[model samples]
Target: MILLGIVLAGAAVCVAVGIIADNTAPATLTVFGQHVPGVSSEAQVFVAGVIVAIFFVMGLAISSLALGRSMRVRQELRDLREEREESLTALELERQQLQRELARARGNQRPTTADIPVAGHRKRDQDPVSPFFDQSA
Candidate 1:
């Protein structure tokens, strides 16, 4: 693409030079009803072409910068997504490890009567109390 652009620019320069050289007739420019002195028609045309080329180059530069910025942003987003996936995987592994440890700890312990609930009795009724306190009432 760079080579193509360079070739096209060289062609345009050649064409503009040819046209300027061929048109030797004296010409004047009138702007707002005032005659501009000493500048030929060819010179005016060349200046206009140069201004257009400058704008074209500026547009290309701006577009390239925008493309670069968008590409960088895309790369950053991809990195963030990968990092998030890694974090989620690590968290899942840690959770599984904690679950295994919890299961192992529970296996190492003995079951007590307090760990089991009695039928037809609330936990508060199961507490030891003095016989004088008639809890059944």
Candidate 2:
């Protein structure tokens, strides 16, 4: 809507300027190395207005396409950031679970030989003697 308004305004200004110039001096325009015979200033103004409208429409189209492309890129970046955050959170949880398991394993350790008991012997740390062969024999 704004673009339309701008184009219309530009056309109106061009036509008004053309009318003023035509009222001031009525003359023929010269082209590239050739004279445009019997061409009025009003006709030149009309041509200039058409050219402005064409350029304005083209500019609007290019800008709209650029905006659409930028929007798509922004969305993709947002999605990628979310995925990365989720992955990082999962890795942290897995690391915490592994640390807990390690701690549990360390706490529940095996007992040493001194902690065990032999049959009818309270001195479990000392070597047992054979009854069949005495030390004096």
Candidate 3:
């Protein structure tokens, strides 16, 4: 993109220089039906070219600022998603730890009806009650 901008700028300069060189006649600008002071055609073309260049630069600056803002927003969204996943993983680990503690407190017996997993809870292929505890102890 930088190279393309540079090439386009160089082309514009070449065109403006050619126009100024070829048109040397005296000229006057009129705005709102009022005749402005007369000047060489080359000077008028140069002023017009300067105005166009200024507007082009302004447009580029505005677009660059908008692009920067968009990129920042995307980065923030990605960071938030990663943070959310990490939080969920931590919560799941805490939940499993709590379930193990509850079973131990109940003397490691089979769960009662009230101890059954809720409908909203994710089903596991293994037994809900962990067998890590040794009843022979």
Candidate 4:
């Protein structure tokens, strides 16, 4: 919306300048030994040139603003992606650490025929039979 306003203002200024140039008589101005003549009442050509120049300048300004905005948005998105990656990495590291701890705790238990020894089996085992001791052949 602000860009639209700026474009409209530029066009208005161009038209006003063209009208003023049309009304004023030709006057020769010298700068750096170069003579510049005033533009006369040729409305069609002068107005067209003015309009073109205005639009060209406006387009350049708008393009610059758009490029800046796009760059900022891209930077923000890149930062968010990096943050997510770091969080996922930390979560995975914690999960792996927990898994290692669980494995270590399980190692303290003895193994049996079923791979899970009965609780306190050694306390009642004067001559504890193996799992297959009483199995019929």
lDDT of 3 by residue, 12-65 (tens): 565555545654344644433444465446577468668657755755666666
Model 1's C-alpha root-mean-square deviation from the true structure amounts to 9.6
User: Highest TM-score among the candidates is held by which one?
Assistant: 3
- Candidate 1's C-alpha runs over 4 A off are 1-39, 108-137
Supply the TM-score for candidate 2. Answer: 0.44
Q: Which TM-score value belongs to model 1? A: 0.51
Better of 2 and 4 by TM-score: 2
List model 1 lDDT by residue over 26-70, tens digit each: 464444344446657767756755864765565556666666777
| Every candidate's lDDT | 0.66, 0.65, 0.66, 0.64
lDDT of 2 by residue, 27-128 (tens): 544433344455667677457557656765665666666667779899999999999999999999999998889878899565678777757778733657
The total number of steric clashes, by the backbone 3 Å criterion, in model 2 comes to: 0
Clashing pairs in 1: none
Lowest lDDT block of 10, candidate 2: 24-33
Better of 2 and 3 by TM-score: 3
TM-score of each: 0.51, 0.44, 0.55, 0.43
Residues 44-90 of candidate 4: C-alpha lDDT, one tens digit per residue: 54654576677766766776777788799999999999999999999
